[model samples]
Target: MAVVSACIVALSGCALPRSGPKDDEILAGSKAEGGPVNVVLVDNRVAVASYLDDNLSFPSSFTGAGLASTDTINPGDVISVTVWENVDPALLVGPGQKQAFIQEIQVDQAGNIFMPYAGVLKAAGNTPEQLRRLITRKLDPQTPDPQVEVRRVAGDGSSISVIGGVGAQGVYPLVPSTTRLSAMLATAGGVTIDPDVAQVAVRRGGTTGRIFLQDLYDDPRLDVALRANDKIIVEEDRRTFTALGATSTQARVPFPQGRMSVVEAVAEVGGLNGNTSDPTGIFVFRREVQSIANKVTGRNDLGENEPFVYVIDLTRPDGVFLAKEFQVRDKDTIYITEAPFVAWTKILTATSQTLSFTADVVRVGDLLTDN
Candidate 1:
């Protein structure tokens, strides 16, 4: 997931440059209108660090018809019976009498439920209403009419857990018929920005399955239903920003879910130091090029692929202008070298230019001879 995100940052960082500044005045005007991008790595700033954690609600459509056929009943299920002709005995009555009125059913591992005169009947594959009918038929010989309602009491109809930025960390009950992963996240209060919607994982019976959260929004089918004992883990979009040389502060800034650009990262670290900052040395070291190259060839080794590292020179008058628009990536290292001699060079150039103009107009012999 991080690899995919990093590729996006690298691709977005290098948008074709616009036409050079028409004039100093135009450059100045553009500079004033647009400030340099402060795309710093996410650090302590919660606003910049946090991503949106959207909770999906229980889908209204995952009903009885959506569930697949399965034969699996669990214990600890609660059931109630309406006896058409049995006498109602209070709990305070003789223990035997009270026990006769209530039958606490327990299903064995074999997927069978115990009921009066029913011995052990298969209840796993049957829905509550279906189970009720099955039990009713079994008791027909003993009782003229028997009404039964079997429902889940302690087990998930089908569930998956949500951890890392979720409101709660327990298993979310899925709609028995067709509860999807999206619905489970909703039931658990969705994910937090810190744990954005990058990837949604579902662990089922020792096997783990994953689906992209964004895919759910694009294709509703991706919000696959949750199954028993499935676990869902969400990863934040931002993790590590690569650090580069010479900047007073060089460290990975943490970002929440979602991607940020190189310029935005610069701002995140606070505007560059006017004295030590060299805009040209600023770079975004990315591995996307190599990863893509490796994929087609089925090679795991880094091979001949070169990680793209963009080095921007801020020494130019207009360089500062582009930094504001360049995107940043996580774990990006920004290096700034002090301006190599711009101050002295500019002063010398101005003085030399003036001297040349004076020499051209008036010969040195003219002043010396007159004196």
Candidate 2:
């Protein structure tokens, strides 16, 4: 019995240590020596939901101006020009020619269109109405009181390209003054991934901007007007957070909707291990921007720019509400410290299994000796 007790002590000593600082220890250290990370203790009295409401906001992509209806002609756009002369005898048309003479012309690479009497007229940058007035003026001397009309038959050059994570990638023509971001996406058969978590990127000229698809739907202002030559791309939101320590499972979890709350993140990783996790030591480690960190910690004397550890004590009922309000950002680390008794429990379980196996071996030896 003495030898067995010694063996039990030795085996129990081999158990893993309960690592990480305790809640009270961390708080005590913070009061004594200031650390790099600003540890914010969350409890029932803290207004976490209100803080999130004040700080977190969806980006607005709406420009001040409304959609412009006047679409300028561009190279490769097919246009039709029609001319009606009132005079009985005309140079281009025969005498008593009441029928209008139509000319189908495509804007050349030089941004000019050819007409019978107008010669080479610039059409790429000018609107259809503006081009009509110019052509009518040019034909004034040749044809008496000439009525000229310019219309775009096909707008191939004025099209937006939709690609990446879409059902069908193709070029969609923009209707004059009508096409918006949502319209272009609809033309491409919508995004392949869930729109709530997907990122919609629009590249125009030399600048590019990206916003969550959910933001676009929530705020119509984010669905800005689409322009010709704009490239729209939809992609899955790859934001993720890692669960470690005493959680039911330890793994990296993706935020499919681009946003996740602390409670949801915990649930995603199979929740905290009931037998091993320390309810008072649940923490979310996040490296926030300096401004945000300063606001959250309310401390300017932080030693380093290390990540802040927001501690949540699940032992209290208010902790559930706080966790629900606490939003989890991308690349965050959620750790649940082990309970103090967990190591001893593990040691006892291991010892019991070992002793049971030894008893079975002794019983088999006794049976063999009797035989």
Candidate 3:
């Protein structure tokens, strides 16, 4: 009995199976002690405020332009010019005909369009009305009271391309009604993915900007005015976080909505395991941005993408509320450690099973001897 007890004690000293490191072990390995990660205690309002300030939003200059209007002519645009003269024989019209139609007149690269008798005229940067007066003046010397009408036609100069995760993917003309970003998206059949998880990216010239699709709806300023030749892409959010350790489920969970808090993320993974999780040992592992790390750690020695582990103790008075306020970013890892007693429980259960098996063997030997 003494030998068996000694063996059981020796086995208990060995490492037991655990889902992850305990709260104390995580603290010991933090960057304060020259460890791999920086440990942050998110127990006060200041800590929560630091993370809340880091949000995803579009640049202020992105929305500076208001709604777009497709009235002025541009290079590569096609316009039709009609000339009407009351004279029996006009310079622009036929000898017997009173009117003549110059169809499919496209604006050249230099913003100029040529007519038969009016010579080369500037069309780009001028409205249809402005171009009409110019053409009438150019032909007034050759034909008296010559009337000219300039009408813009379908062309590639004033159009945008909408693609990726939309109901329709094509180049849509920017008309008077569908010139804004949201209106153009609607013209392309809106977005096919859920608005909460959709991302909108706009590329114009050499600059580009991105924002959440929901942000475009919640804030009117985010819906900037569209421009000609702008390329818009709508796609699903690819950001994800890994849930491990004693949680009810361990997997890579996709963000269901924008601006997800720590509490919401834990709920997404089925919360912590009631049988084994330590409420005080919930940890979020991530790489903090350099600027944010400097503010959070109160030091400026950190390099870019500093390794960070944010600790949350739900057992504390303000732990749950703090977790509710703290935001979780992309590629973060949430780990919940098992309770300390759970290890002792497993050891005791194993010891008891070993003793029970030994007793059963002794009882069988005694019965065999009696037989």
Candidate 4:
């Protein structure tokens, strides 16, 4: 018996939850001191939808940052180059000398470009500017000093894909080393109100990481280095917000950010339905994993093991305040009860729920009340 117990402990690492509430609580809880939790937080996510999605080229100024991009040019890649020799305008100067003939440059199997005098030179792995300099160096020997310009007429470096919740989709500018994914989101015109920042996926080769676009506004942790031939996908979270109980105005909003909290969510909807608001009866329906089976499958529904619901009373000053700061994830239904009097409204919800795209409905409820 003793040996069997010891073996069980050792094997716990590989064990999967069986089923029920106990399993969900153990596997799907948040790591933060007060994290917004649920089966969805573990599965679905979209950080901030209200903010602008930056879609710009690698900033001309991001040259010094140690951004590492694993992007490389392979064969069959097409490119365009505009070459010049001293003051001679014939090689590149168009028929009217109005513009130039170089629209797109193509690379050959030999890995070279046939410029007027520079002949063929290596371009794979080198940036446009890097390629330009290589061409200039070759021409300088024959011409006093030469100027060379290179553009990706049709190639991997010039194309970028924007997905998820933005107004526009498809490829945009192929920014340089300094450009980040957030910059491109803005270029595509930012995310819609039902934005999916968390599930925004970026894949290079087999490597992938979830990007939190909201973090782009301040936190540097979520920053992802851009690369050519990389795909940035905005994935959607399938869920909804169900508002029920004492609040005057209640409805289901979009569900993609996981479970939202009582107070933060209430304020987001415009604060308790003023006319007849209850201070108690605030409840948020959340998903709590009960067993390993529920967690392993990434399920948000409560299992027989765990019933995920918290009756948070906003009547008490302390509880009321916690509601303002806590987040509400997707699949969370925030129920605000009516307060005894407008008297409680005197206190300001200075630290309230983060603004969202859906309509805000404040519910007044007693933290101790049962739904």
Candidate 5:
């Protein structure tokens, strides 16, 4: 029994159950498969700044200024041309007819429209007024004074496609009033999801860019102008982080906002468990890029795929402030370890339970001997 008790005492550290790894255990397992562990102590301003630098943002490709005019004629637009000649014999209409009304004339793919007597004229890149003047010049030789009026109607080339997470998903035309992205979205009916979590992706030509729908409301500059053939998609934000160990709740929590800090993420999971949480062992695990890993760990030799663990101790005076500034990235694992005393209590409780079971067996043997 003495030998068995001695063995149990020596092996208790390895055999004890735990909610998650301790701080030292996590550090000891940093290196794996020949890659060095990049443990970053996020207790200072520098470390917090390094993590904040990795925030997701709208690139320049998405934020550039867009064209202000939506009235220009493009291919596949429907145009209407009406001609009125005051002379006795009209060049475009019959002798008795006072005016010629041509309607529903669709612009061809080459951006040219044809009139009965005016021939084919370039209509694209010209506003309705400009195109009207062009047509008047074309018929001026035949008639003394030709008055031409050009009207642009809705068609394929002047419209955009709005789909996903909206009240109505379909093709919408870009008129004078609905030329901006927000106006187009409003025409299609507002987003079906929460504006806070909604993401809007704009695909123009060969490039695509995504931004939070709420961003358009926050900064009017981000409300980009809509163009022909542009595809806009609205969807929910998919960024998330995992919470484990001595937290009050353990689960995968989605980002409540576009830019979230470590402290905010902790609060999303109901904060740390009061009974077993170790304030000094709060950690955020991530697969970090080489440049950011170098900045956080002060190591130039780190690889792009290295694993990083950022530690934050709430007991320090600056810890809470650091956590507030340190950004929580997508796919990060936020873990709070159990207190040291909790493990010792577990060991004591297990040993007491074992001793009680052993005494019960011995009493049973004594009863058999008496029988």
Candidate 6:
């Protein structure tokens, strides 16, 4: 009997109440503390729905200045010049020379292109049409009514660059016809990672902006026109959160590039452990900037912008709707406390096993004595 009592005492001690405060108690403590980090009880329907509707949005379009549409002649560009003199061909060239003169020239580093009668002419910084007019003006003295046409055969100076997380990385030339962002990405063989979770970054001039790939697809206006020398990058999404406590799995889980709700986050972690999880104790721990915290809780005295604990009571049937509306942010901690009964169940099971073993020992001793 003494042995049984000892076992019972040990089991009872193991069954002592959990150490942490209850869900409601935690909220009350936060209210009393008046600290920067506030504990918000998400027990209502209106607040959850309003937050979800207000805070979820795709990032705005990049408004930074980009390359201009005008294509100027640059060094290393192949320029083809053709001159036509209908009447006095001999004045431009030798006697009995053909009426038309065609020359293929490359713009030199000094921004100049040489012609037979026009001498060395500045081609760089001038459009093809502008250069043709200049060439015709220069040849007016040597030939009678000379007509000149200037064409650029190969010039890669006005091209956009596609690199990083793409199937192919290279400089893609931009034509006036196909200058949209989607065209440039398709030319580079598209992104290597999952498009749903990838982010597209556009760098132009000294400014850079990013948008999720899904946003570009959802809104056609987001596929803005591309410019020369712009850089487009696609990379894997970095938004993630950690799951802990009585969740089915405890691990870091990445969310889709777009908005993710608490319901989606829970499902990603394999949902709560049905037997151990306390339906009333679902919590999300998050830290926000001072301004954000103040705006969120409507409290002015938030100390150094500490973390906030947002609790959702899953025991209520309306919790499912609230969970669907509660957005989960990056680096958040999703925790589900164990049920109160779980500890008592463990203690009782251990006590029962100990009693059964003790009874067997006594029975064996009795059999030995009878023998």
How many clashing pairs per prediction, in order? Answer: 38, 0, 0, 65, 0, 2
Candidate 5 residue lDDT tens string, 1-371 = 79457646864856687888888888776653333666667756555556644433455756676665777889999988889898877777787887999998898999988887779999888999999998888889988888888888898869999999998999988887888888989899889998878899888888887888877888887787777888999988898999999999999998888888889999999998999999998999888888877776666987886788888989999889888988888899999999998887787677777777878999999999999
> Could you tell me which residue pairs clash in candidate 5?
none
Q: How many backbone clashes can be found in candidate 4?
A: 65
| Candidate that scores best on TM-score | 3
Q: What's model 6's TM-score? A: 0.80
> What Cα-based lDDT does every candidate model obtain?
0.51, 0.75, 0.86, 0.52, 0.83, 0.75
RMSD of candidates 1 onward, in order: 16.0, 4.2, 2.8, 19.2, 3.2, 4.4
**Model 5: lDDT of residue 280:** 94
Task: Report the lDDT tens digits of candidate 6 across residue range 206-286.
Answer: 867688888888777677777667799888888899988788899898886477878888888899888888888888887
Candidate 4 on 142-186: residue-level lDDT in tens? Answer: 765655677655454445677767778877655453367677777
Model 1 over residues 197-243: C-alpha lDDT tens digits? Answer: 36666665655655456656666656665555567787654456745
Candidate 1 similarity to native, TM-score: 0.55
Among residues 3 or more apart in sequence or in different chains, the pairs in candidate 6 whose N, CA or C atoms overlap within 3 Å are: 36-302, 36-303
lDDT: worst 10-residue window of model 5: 48-57
Question: Using Cα atoms with residue i matched to residue i, what is each candidate's TM-score against the true structure?
Answer: 0.55, 0.80, 0.89, 0.48, 0.87, 0.80
- lDDT score at residue 354, model 4, on the 0-100 scale: 18
Best by lDDT: 3
Tens digits of per-residue lDDT, candidate 3, 244-350, equal 99999999999999888889999999988999999988889988888888888778888888888888889898888988888898899999999988988878777
TM-score ranking from best candidate downward: 3, 5, 2, 6, 1, 4
Ranking by lDDT: 3, 5, 2, 6, 4, 1
What does candidate 5 score in Cα RMSD to the true structure? 3.2
Q: Which ten residues in a row have the lowest lDDT in candidate 6?
A: 49-58
